[model samples]
Target: MAKYKIWVVAAATLLLLAGCTSLPGTSSSSSSKATKKLQTTGKVTDSMYEGVIDNGQYKTSQTRGLTTQQSNTSFDVKSLESGLLKLSKEQFPTSKYVFQEGQSLKTAQAQKWLARKSKTNTEGLNPEDNGQKDPNKRNPIYLQQILEQDYLGEDGSMKGMSIGLGMNQVDYYTKEQYGATFETKISKAMMTQQGKQMANKVLSRMRQKKGLSDTIIVIGLYKQAPKDSLVGGTFFAYGVSKKGSTTIDSWHELNQENQVLPVVNDEKAINQDDATAFNSFKTQVETFFPNLSGVTAQTHYEEGVLAGMNITVNTQFYSETEIMSFTQYIATAADKYLPRNIPLDISITSAEGMQAYVGRASGSKGFTTHVFGSY
Candidate 1:
């Protein structure tokens, strides 16, 4: 099954400046005579989101079926195991296979595979060679490069099958080259059948393993463009067998397009809730600082939970003291109006520079405000 985890977004910026250093008590003339030099600016702006309001209308939807669980009966372990042993002994005598009882690929192993594939795919493709015309358009790495070693059995047969499902490869290639207007209906139909056939083959082989009687086998597939490293499509298929059964009973294929929001009742309701919260926060900031030129509030969510709330205010001018006070006022308002557990990120930008407040959502109650920026 696909692993569920919180997603965090990080943004970084770089600034450069030129200046001349002067020693304390140094004469103005001597200071002016010194050579100019580049200097680093000590300014930082951090932002975080607070949780969403507890609106009864808002709910999470489970649309993606990339993970599944099932049981099967009549699973032919003897036949499957025999095939695997034969394949190991004759087809691939020097391969290694790894078996694990999880839906998603192991994090560390996946990273190592991705790193190696990235290096190989980008090899010799430099700006001078015309291969770097577009970094994002570089040639796609083969699936084998990413999952081969992980699925190779020590005896040379396959340990687990990893297949890319969804649109047929031919139709995918055709559409990429000629757009969707081309006649690929027949090819697409053929491709779908092929995907099922391939899935069945892998499922049959995996069922033959010693201890997979009543468990689900999840095989993940990632579809990428011919020359792109990013996965554009994802799919999952499983073979289900029941305990004490000799044959497989169910087969499932989950494509990205077929996913449904099974848990979330209405996405629009959640969006409206976020908009309402942001407007309320924005109004409070404006009321506190009438002279503010412009102000905006944004809300962020993770797995349908309020993760952070961010507010940015712009003014014609600002002082260090004023910025600090403004941040404190906003923090206070956040604690009073927003949820207690999330974080609040407030930024104030003016003609001079910028300042920011990064702390807990419940104002500055439990955490100290970390304010840093140029004057």
Candidate 2:
């Protein structure tokens, strides 16, 4: 009945080892460069991330400050933020255009767009309430959230924009005023349609705000996971709106997918071979050390091919020697069991903290290891 959203997930990305050793397990110490003065620069990362330069300082998203965090999972948030930039590059290449957080979409405007549609505020993107108190009869909020990113030319002018629509696969709501919470599953077909339609409407409004009718706009439709999902959602499709248009001219489908380790369900396995490899790696670690808690992994894929994997190894031991030994063993196990020619990062963590780290960059010959505090 109301725009009440809750998100119970919050986490930071895995730490990138500051010190490490290359394959063959030879230890080496490394130090980072000295801090440099801020400049009016826009640096793009290998992950397709581009930052803006405002008065010699990099700026973050304006809409990000408005996120409740309780209403969305960190996985979904990360995927949306990163995936949108990656997709937008197809149209707004980093070579010519720089990346900036959506500045045209203000906090109040985004809040209004995310609110439930009602007579008092028709600008709400979600469907208007039907005067019904029954949860089943009420219209579910298919559109959960909206994200905006801007593309800027070298001259600091707006070149293009990318908009991400976060569609909820499950709507959490109450049957009546202050009643018990109930969830309604939203089918993929309905969610996609609503997202596409919302994109058109959003374009119209954006054009009105800053004469964006003459600007190129990218739209990313993301299907968010359930409220209690461990992993975030994936972008299923994206579209481009050419200049002088407020609607998408063409849509392209994206086949990016992610899988949680331990093979939650055999029937839902993304790839049987990959699962076998992960299982073997897990078995090797457990067999060597029985006191360890568990080992799990998350696989990322693009166009049905394994692109990257982030593995987490939980343990109960706190000894530095034990951690170093375990890290060395896992690096070997990963080489034997994990897929080759793909980026992979393993975090060995315990109640104390992250004990050790192992990683392999894409196209790299071998993995790198770093025992925390050793360097």
Candidate 3:
């Protein structure tokens, strides 16, 4: 219903402009073209995604799912607040827009950070079936960090994390679902800005239906083009929710007898470092979920899977204010750094109260992590 309303309003605005235009000559062609484009709308329609192939099998599809975490903690509200304030200022220095209601600058930045780009204007990617491991697999920790830094306050403060997972699969979608594509590699700024605009519209609608609250986390899957094929973008939707002490760690311990941890995932290709600084982020989460223990972390490498463990002690007092504070802190710590610009903080607000949320989304020979945990 809300989507319909937005479309209606947008159409009305366009029609009003058309009514004011003098359209008997070249103006007629221009107006007609503009109207056709507007009618096309950047949104993917049901008919656009009718025949998609998932893993080689032809099937019709729709997208939907849920992932969340909920827990009690001992962190004091003051500590949480102090932590969140600091974290927010660092993660989102220019983030003046309210996260859930008006203005969303962080969302704009994040979409810009993740949108894809091609080197050649007319180049195309073959659905490479090399059977090689996917380089884009998101580490569970990486996903978590994106949330802490991008969505929560500076100290990881959040009231309560409200997470929602949805999936939208059309039978067939085309490049028209999204806007224009330049031949030369488009700049990240351009893609991110476009992505930001889309993200804001979706989030604003969610806010209207659910009420104005900063405590919401969402991850959704939209129809994606085939691997190497140009189509619309669809994957995850996450927002901020809450923060508590929970042991979150990521590391790579190669079985090889090299001096330091060998930068390898398996017996095959070896180059990408599995031990990024973000991989060692564990103690930070423990500050929220003290009783967190017996948890294990692992990465599926070319050889097999590397595993590690940690026991996070609830090292702080807990309260409403404390929980909110902790929420913001964890969100910041989990954000992704984009060189000089303030790091892009990903929001996962809904998963705040969930016990554990873990899953995977695979498309175009690529896969992304969908994991959430609480104590």
Candidate 2, residues 2-104, lDDT tens digits: the string is 0001111111111111111112222111211211221223232333323454554445566752432227876777767666766776788656665667888
Give the best candidate by lDDT: 2
Per model, state how many residue pairs clash. Answer: 27, 4, 88
lDDT of 1 at 112: 39
For residue 342, model 2's alpha carbon misses the true position, in angstroms, by: 2.3
**Candidate 3 structure lDDT:** 0.24
Prediction 1 global C-alpha lDDT = 0.34
Model 3 per-residue lDDT tens digits across residues 1-375:
001011111222233233333322212121233332111111122111011112333221111111111111111111122222222332333222111111222443333223222343111111212332223321110110012112323222332222211111211122233544212122334333332343344444334433234444332211221223211122222223222212112211212110112223343322234334323344446544563432222221212221111112222333444444555554444432111111111222222343222111111122122223423
Off by over 4 Å in 2: 1-50, 65-70, 133-135, 265-267
Candidate with better TM-score, 2 vs 3: 2
- Models ranked on lDDT: 2, 1, 3
What are the TM-scores, per candidate, against the unseen true structure? 0.33, 0.83, 0.20
Whichever of 1 and 3 has more lDDT, that candidate is 1
Compared with the true structure, all predictions reach lDDT values of: 0.34, 0.70, 0.24
Cα-based lDDT at residue 21, candidate 2: 15
- The number of residue pairs in model 1 that clash at the backbone is 27
Best by TM-score: 2
